[model samples]
Target: MKGNTLQPMTMPFRVGNVAPDPEREHAAPVRIPIGPEATLLKEPLLGRYASTRRDIDLDMDAMRAARSRGELPPFGGPWFGGMEKDVAWVNTTRVIGDASDAEELTRAEVTGRKDSVVMLDALREHSPAFKDGRLLHTSTQIGVRETRCLLGAYTLTGDDIRTQARFDDGIAVGCWPIDVRPAGDVGVHAMYVPLPYEIPYRSLLPRKTDNLLVAGRCISVDREALGSARVGATCAATGRAAGVAAALAATGGKQPRQLDAGQLRTAVRAQGGRVTPPAH
Candidate 1:
């Protein structure tokens, strides 16, 4: 595989599960009350957020609409599934910095928190439902999307996802599209994948690391490929595969790279994971 030439991307944001105040009277009757559960997708107010340094992009109208949800998970699912809530505080403020820079990341944390408050203020101004609303809980730390990645024994690329590439050592499967939030862009740039693709165990094996195995978004993948591989479900699948491999390596007294691929695939399949493309 060729050396990684893509720069790591970063998106710093916060989430607050909000609830409406019972004592407050609504200027406009709550049209669509925040529900028990909802789906998530990209919002339309990102352009406004991108231009204003201290502003956030949230779909205020959708909060009242039943369809309003955020895409924090793969397959366009909601992260806060079973939470019994009325409102979701979706903060769209962003911070960009080098992943290796501690000062920048620290700034992201501080800035992200401050911006989240700014978003809350905007929400209050946008709707009266939250005029007296209270925050149930807020994210303690800023969420960072990408950082330094490992160039492992095998590299998963965007082409692999599009063509549904399968490997003999396949350990996990991902079907999320190539969703990238470019720095200073209005919204995410997405390239939908045709089908689910396999993640090889070789991608988890670092070239120089003897016994160490990498998983999740940090596994060997190019920049374009990371866009699709960097979601919660995909990350979890890769993590489980890595854990299984790690356990097998420890028990067998062998390096992770030296483990049998077939054995690992069988073990993962036994655990109810999809290491190959699903039949259409």
Candidate 2:
């Protein structure tokens, strides 16, 4: 995070509540029911699984008023509604800003909270299901999608992902596509990856920072590559590898960069991580 910074992108301030349409009577239960029916203004839902509303018209005039008053950002598409175990759920919120800076991060947090109110209001006023629904929770902080990236021993690139490159030091695997929520763009652009790719241990070793090992979305990767690696599963895998590598390094009195890649890979694989490429 110290060497260089990745370009900022839109991050959501997600909201969740007990299922507004518990019966799934109006909401489509399928993974992502796409079309004009699912959107507020009949504008095809922008992002993936954009919203849960189906065959319902929301108040467009009211949404316009909120936008004019600067209460909402350009993008406020909903994206989560389903059952989580016994509890039903709904998430309809969006707030976008460059959160790499401390001040900007704070601003995003405030704006996200405000946007949540506007989105919830829109839902309650138009959707009968949400009108009587109980509020479960809202995220306390803005989801920081990308920030400063480490310039490390190796920087993963889009080419590596496309080619399904393997590394002797591989400690984790990633399968998400290149998902980019452009600044102020309502829809996201994504490029599917052909196969799962290896994430090397070198990517976690920050240059000139022997005592530290970076992981998650902030690990060494190009902008195009970051788009793919920034998802939750990939981030979790990288974090796991970093944790294992750190423990091994500390015990051996070695810096992260100096630890043997083979030993690290073995340790990671032992933890049930996919370190080697699948057998052909």
Candidate 3:
């Protein structure tokens, strides 16, 4: 499948302007209530604990009403809420269009900027916290979700995740569920996975390129499986595995595929990674 491109967004707080060594603790559990009309296409906001009342809800009723009246273009979804000290971040605009096409991408970027302005206006009008807030910055670059996936030694599939298949060369674990967005009339289809599943080392090894090792979201995986494995934490784990395997291969004067899976697992474990499956 073709890889996805990023959706550009703006932030409330400016970077670098904030004091160094900012508060290191979450004061309380931040839970933003989503309106019934909000079509959350992804998972809920998650973070560590703090006892302070920093929570804020993203009421999409205004946006939904505007959509119904054809006042705004349907481009992107909102990020419920997030905060870093005095600065809060929310993504309520998305430039819904083809990301691959040059002309469309340009248009999407423009639309994204405009949407951010509108979203900020709405936030300032409705949310008390954002009443005095100013736009700190807009992302310099657009983020791409999917692009090109390498055809590796082994490609992960939805069935592998569903069955919780174990691989002798498993190097990383993924726990996120399949979160595919809706297309046309089809609604968002999300499948929850209770258990963490293995991501095999072979998935990082490109089939034809002996020297190349793939990691992160670009690693070999079917579209359905990609949804679970593409998250930040899972990608980080896979990246660590790839780094370790690459170093071992380089030292041994061997290709990534030539490195023994057992040795790799041993090295990964030494570095505080859990390569073995938990006792069933």
Distance (Å) between predicted and true CA of 80, model 2? 1.2
Q: Say what the RMSD of model 2 is.
A: 5.9
The candidate scoring highest on lDDT is 2
Clashes of each: 3, 2, 17
> What is the lDDT ranking, best to worst?
2, 3, 1
Models 1 onward score TM values of 0.70, 0.74, 0.74
Models ranked on TM-score: 3, 2, 1
lDDT of 2: 0.65
Q: TM-score of the candidate numbered 1?
A: 0.70
Clashes of 2: 2
Model 1 residue pairs with clashes:
32-64, 40-69, 40-70
Lowest lDDT 10-residue stretch of candidate 3? 12-21
Judged by TM-score relative to the true structure, which candidate is superior, 1 or 3? Answer: 3
182-218: candidate 3 lDDT, tens digit per residue: 3321112334443568999999998888888989989
Off by over 4 Å in 3: 1-27, 30-54, 75-77, 97-108, 126-128, 183-191, 277-280
lDDT of 2 by residue, 156-188 (tens): 998898788989899988876665545552323
